[model samples]
Target: MGREQEELWDAETAREYDTPGTGMFAPEVLGPTVERLAALADGGAALEFAIGTGRVAVPLARRGVPVTGIDLSRPMIDRLRAKADGATIPVVVGDMATATAPGTFRLVYLVFNTIANLLTQDAQVACFRNAARHLTPGGRFVIELWVPELRKLPPGRQAVVCRVETGYIGLDTYDTLHQHVVSHHFTFGAGRDARLFRTPHRYIWPAELDLMARLAGFALESRHADWNGTEFTAESPSHVSVYRLPHDG
Candidate 1:
């Protein structure tokens, strides 16, 4: 994250970031995520990239796997600290691509398409290398990202509406030439005007992600449609990918 990103995810954004008991916060949605990450942690410490507001980190910590995080936004980390002690759930405030945290870990994971937030090929690649540098031998790096919807975009169309729920809307505009997409979120409530938040991302194919992992001294361990290990098919909208470093290297 940088100046622009920090501004986009500022205090107001952090305040509204959590949607408890519904949407992403629903037990059904978050439980599976925490369960999978806990299993991946394998009784060792875990490192989270861009640990926003401690949503998954908190529950994962409750599962008894020690957790550390690196993030660029102090405001988001502040929100997390409000929920859990900085000493108990340590966080280093810096860019996930280059920030260093103490000690090695059994797992390094980035969820909610945070890897796409790097917004460039080189930065995303560097993120992979960073995760590798922070992991012990044979440790795993996990990422959850949406598969690009390029196939649905007709000729000359640049944007698509991804979600349209009551009082909320999500849209994405693509720039295929640059491998970029901007996510636009609209939120509305009673007696209030709708608010919009936009984030830019660099869309990546699974093959390219694999290549980046390989470049960073990792091999593809597994990929699935979601946390429960659903088989990933061509039509799947998103994927949870696991990559591993060589034990001997």
Candidate 2:
């Protein structure tokens, strides 16, 4: 990741990143995610790409699935260290696409649309190769990503509201030509200025992601609409995909 993009998720954002027991951190969302990953680890060590704030790693580790992480944000890693031991869930503060962690893993996973953070086809491809580098033969690499919502865009429209609540709202604006989406988050409070934070992502289609995996010497293993093992269909908004390296390789 570039300096500009790294700075986008500075300390302030890291501090507010964890929303325990609600939103993405809710038991309903996180539990199944960690469960499936733990199952994939299959009693072996695992590696996480862009593992932020111990959201999934902590619980997975508590389950006795040895977990390690590679991320780019020091502040985010600091927050994770505050929640868990750095020695137990060790993290390397560098780009996940290129950073090296010691040893091979039974499973290497990336979650929560983090693959899109690389922002370029080459970088995304490099990420798959990096995951392949870390995984044991026949090991799996999983990713959770939102399917592009381009069909929801009306003709000549480029923005949509993705979330609305009492104190927060999320708006995503598309750059269709470049296949980019910038999410603008607005938080409101009584007698205070509305706070805004934005994040940009380069979204990828499932087909393209599969091709990237293939280029990295992996084959698509499975895909589901969510962590519950639900069937993926045309209407599913997001997908959890698994890719595996050849046992011989």
Candidate 2 lDDT for residue 213: 97
Worst ten in a row by lDDT for model 2: 240-249
Q: Give the TM-score of candidate 2.
A: 0.97
- What do the candidate models score in CA lDDT, each in turn? 0.94, 0.93
lDDT of 2 by residue, 44-158 (tens): 9999999889899999999899999999998898999998988899998899999999988999999999999988889999999999999999899999999999988999999
Instruction: Give candidate 1's error at residue 249 in angstroms.
Output: 6.5
- Tens digits of per-residue lDDT for model 1, 123-148: 99999999999999999999999999
TM-score of each: 0.97, 0.97
- What TM-score would candidate 1 get against the native? 0.97
Steric clashes per prediction? 0, 0
Q: How many Å off is the CA of 97 in candidate 1? A: 0.3
